[model samples]
Target: MPPATLSRTEQSYLLDGLRSKPAERADRRDLHEYRMMQVDTDLSLQADGSARVVLGSTEVHCGVKAEIESYDAPHVNVSTDLEFAPWLPPSPRVQVMVEYSPALLHEHNATELAMITDTVQDMLQACYALTGNSIGPLDARQFIVVPYARYWVLHLDVYVMSWSGGNVLDAVFAAAFCAMYQARIPGTKILALDKAAARQDDEVDQDDPAGIKFITRGRKPSSSAALDDAVDFALENEWDHGRLLAGREDVPVCISIYPFEDTYLLDPTLEEETALSSSIAVLASARGHIYGIRQRGSGELTLDAIHKAADVGASYAKQLAQTLQARFV
Candidate 1:
């Protein structure tokens, strides 16, 4: 990119503006308030939860929705709108729907999008486990024996409304935290899974002096055959009728950084983003379990820098988790 022409006074003013903005602090250091700029919330209607987050002009919108599906792939568990369109290919026995829409993927550069999706999935799965059984209110054994294939699905959609270039992944993570915090899952009671289908009428009524029922279920798809069967089942029924469900809890927090020069920028401006040589994002659970780390793109980040980034990510993650948790109160 060619440099823009400016008079000496204009150049001085620009330099002064840049100087007034604090230099990037070391990863382990606390993030200064001035450097962070601003934080905003509330954006989305249809989702169970939603938030529009802004960090120094960089913008990302996040929404959380829940549904029932029989199966899901492990790594791509975030289940954002980005992957909804691709049509799955038809094998000799099955068809895989796959579609390509640049509009969805265009928001973030290609590599960044991949990182964000994976990070969110890991976090949400952790929360899902606390909700109880993987398949539904019933255990896998019950579901397999009876097999009412309806699965509850949670879709967390992230939209990049604006990008000034800084670390979009970090911003994406923050927005996701806010959205998930605002989300809630309805109380659902498990019915008989062995019957192939369960009805709302079969729900154990707590008020009727009858009784209460609840059960447990995330298995990621490993093979095309497995995915096919799951998809076939998901498309075939609707099973969340009478299940005791819990509100959302334990959201995973992510911190992302793009490394440039010897200095590491927390969120790079568009110009810095273009200048970056490499990027790494670290996702941590509230317990400090390092669930995922994605290191890719063209940059050369040193081993030391990588560790430092994790520390930075972990700190910010804790702060994010605390802030979001407060929202629930």
Candidate 2:
């Protein structure tokens, strides 16, 4: 469908309907109802994990890629993105990218597109802070190629193929969430090398195929991290497909609400979004824990409105998770 180019007459028609005492949606959905979303996984043969989500006419594709890296690299300036967490000294981290097709330039300027992608990335990073998988000896070791020396840098790329409606961030996050759920990291094994078998390059990785074993040890690995140098690990039977990860339930569901003063809209269309006073996107779990909050539009939001929207979003997230849980199984 072409961009929702509404004339003054069409705009008034929509605003009038929405501004009424009992707001009416053109699609006939309840005031706070979301359209059904269709999700498909394993779409990319090259990606370790991949999923596509369709919410109404908006479509997003998420692919997960990870590379084992050593701790010797420079530290990421995460202070801007996440609060100081001692456990995060040097562990698995995620890189989320929100890329929109160039065709979307017809509807949004370059600055607008960049801002949207940045906001989505921030929202996801906040959510990751809340759900950064359990990394301990007893827990499932995620992204630990070798204890203390190397870890995985998980890359989550979300492509907005098309945006016909509101909820672009919602759809993007949903696709990323599903893709991470489906993602599997390849297993790693330690091969003790004799001094003779090891290469002569002592400055760094000496003939390290995985680049996990460093010639010299630096900072000690965080105890709360995935693995310790002393901890021994090996999979019973590992394959190219990799192993399914745990803590899928830790992933939060993203829900955005468009607020028109006292009225709110869920899953608004492009035209509907245009008439909104403001919008709030919240990342929350089915258990009602709010992870992050982002506000858009120039209009101010009341504290009461923010509270109500968060509550509504959290409630809806539970239902959405329940609806999709079966497919994950």
- How well is each residue in 1-329 modelled by candidate 2, as lDDT tens digits? 12366888998999888877677779888777778899999898888889999988899999998776655333222434321213223433676677889988987788878877787777776555423334311122455554335566778788888888667878887887788777877666654322321332222232443333331322223332222224333443443468766566657777888877666788888788776657888887656667777787878988999898888888887777656666787
lDDT of each: 0.46, 0.66
lDDT of 1 at 51: 83
Q: Would you give me the overall lDDT of model 1?
A: 0.46
State the displacement of the C-alpha of residue 118, model 1, in Å, after optimal TM-score superposition: 10
RMSD of 2: 8.4
What lDDT is reached at residue 239 by model 2?
35
| lDDT tens digits, residue span 108-212, model 1 | 455655554555444434333322232211122212211233334456566666555355566666776676556554544443432211222233343421111
Clashing pairs in 2: none
